[model samples]
Target: MLIMGEVHTGLLRNLGELSETECREVLRLTSGEEPRTWQRPLLYAISPDVLTGVDCRLPSSSGARIRGTGTVSHRATIVGGRVLQGSSYTTLLRSDSDQRLPWSHYLAAPGVVEVYGRPRWQDMADGFVTPEPPMDVLNVGAISGRLMGAVQDSARLDRKTPFKTTRTRLRWLFERDDARGDGRPAMRLTLGRDTMRTLRFTGEPTTDVVAFCEDLALHDWLLTTLQTLIQRALIGTAAPAQIAARLSPAIDHLLHLWMPGARVEEPFLPFWEELERHPGFTRQWTSSVARIRDQITVNTLSLLSVTESRREADGDPSPRRGVPQDRTQSHSHPVRRRIFFRADQRSRRRS
Candidate 1:
């Protein structure tokens, strides 16, 4: 759908915030909806902002005549006093513009998707170039002379907060004459005494906590790497083989460490041997996938071919059953059979 709107030409060149009334007009035209006082404009275009093409699809090879085959132009006009008083215009470009344009996609956020308004590689590159002058540069000689002063004020205010107050109390405890190493309390819950012998060796509480955190990070890394290797075996063989070949030795080292041990409950002896020995694993896995796919395609073709032949031979007007359909029924029935067979095997294992 295309939306068109006409605005006054006078306020085209001004740059600044627009008035509530002006915003309403733009919203009404583009979104085909009413604008509220609190609502912000999703797409803004003032009169002076010259829109070269309103079409969505235009061929570059078409040269000068290509004129926005699927482009829409929204020109922002800046006028006197920068009040942004001028009216705006909108053009609905053709849908084919999406096809002719080269577009790039990226994850803007978890669910929300943002598409670059332009569809050119150069535009994508140029999009990253910053145009605004730095705030410090704009302020000139009055640069952050009061930065330390503001920081001092913040520090004074923060010192009174309960969290900061706890640190202050802890600091006072450190200065006590009666303070002994064995009397120190736990940093976390107060339920248990965490006294340790004061040693001459240099040891800080912060350093101990940081070391503990680093060990935890290493454990997570090991788990993630192991899972990646396992999943890789199911995906592409060559990539997984290359990764496993490089990482298996390091994984072995981690498993040896008590602090960062492998999470696998069972020994994983067979799984490890399979990965370690199978250079042909990738070739075998890929070949299996190809064979399965080919069998499916060939079976489908043969079933259709057989069904047609049967219909011709019998001269039956009703639809003939294909071999593929029969095979599908046979496959579905095996699921129940397999489940019962596996349960029976488990019963034997228990016995």
Candidate 2:
């Protein structure tokens, strides 16, 4: 089986975390249908699955236009009442008939795209992941963005976010173990500007591809958001206090949302484990978070030290209060930057 999907993840446009009730209301996409909610690990909810019809050209790496027709599944989610994601995917199944099927037939099998005519499936897969697929191609991301906008632009949300982070899109492909001739697992992860692509071949017989995709998207969003936040923070140039202030939003809303593979099925865990070993998504996230916390700690200590020094300066019973305080006598370091500045600079160099 072949499946290609896209997920768009972003910080829910809210000043702070939304209540469980509010999250439910915000994700209510279907009329009178309540969104699915769970409490374990953290507050999580998913809107009922919706279907979107697409009769468009499939992507072709060789520039050969292949036609595909069918429906794409879309759903919205709220994680920890802070992060929001819109996911859309289609399972590509070979159609025995070359003729177009009735609309009712396509509707019956929601989220399945039946490929028409003879075209290399590999070419189609390659085209989909290409940096720039042809304009007139099946774009799962574009479809996903609309659903994302629907929830994100909802009136229920105040659209007031603590940090200025935008949505990150993940485009991925997954194939079953039996489909491959050799039957060995395979995986590839690619990161670009505000976008990521994952290719996976799993030997396990599991039907949790959508869940896995969303999970990957959620964690990748956390990773991408922090990576971008640190860049804009000007770590080396910004003082410890300033940097900490810049990263406070992440600490408040995102740090607690780092539960990886929490909701994924047991069979697909190895793919995530492989990624952790190589590119190391969680590893980088942990390092960045540790540095942010360290900055906060240093900022707190620096403030207290300065406060104590000022108390001593003022407590001096001598006539020093009357005279102008010497700059050398100040307790606060003139160079306010902390150890993070050098560490960040060296990391940048290595990168």
**TM-score per candidate, in order?**
0.16, 0.86
Q: Which lDDT value does model 1 have at 318? A: 57
Best prediction by TM-score: 2
| TM-score, candidate number 2 | 0.86
lDDT of 1: 0.27
Instruction: Give the top-scoring candidate (lDDT).
Output: 2
Q: What is the lDDT of candidate 2?
A: 0.79
Residue 79, model 2, lDDT: 97
**Residues 241-266, candidate 2, lDDT per residue (tens digit)?**
66767788878888899988999988
Candidate 1 per-residue lDDT, tens place, 1-351, comes to 112121111111213334455544433323433533332222222222222222222222212122233222222221111112221222222233333343221111111112223433222212212122233211101111121122223221222211110000000001111222554431211111221111011123221221222222233333333334344434333322233333343233323332221222233223223332543333443444454344334434433444444454588645444344444333333334444344334544754
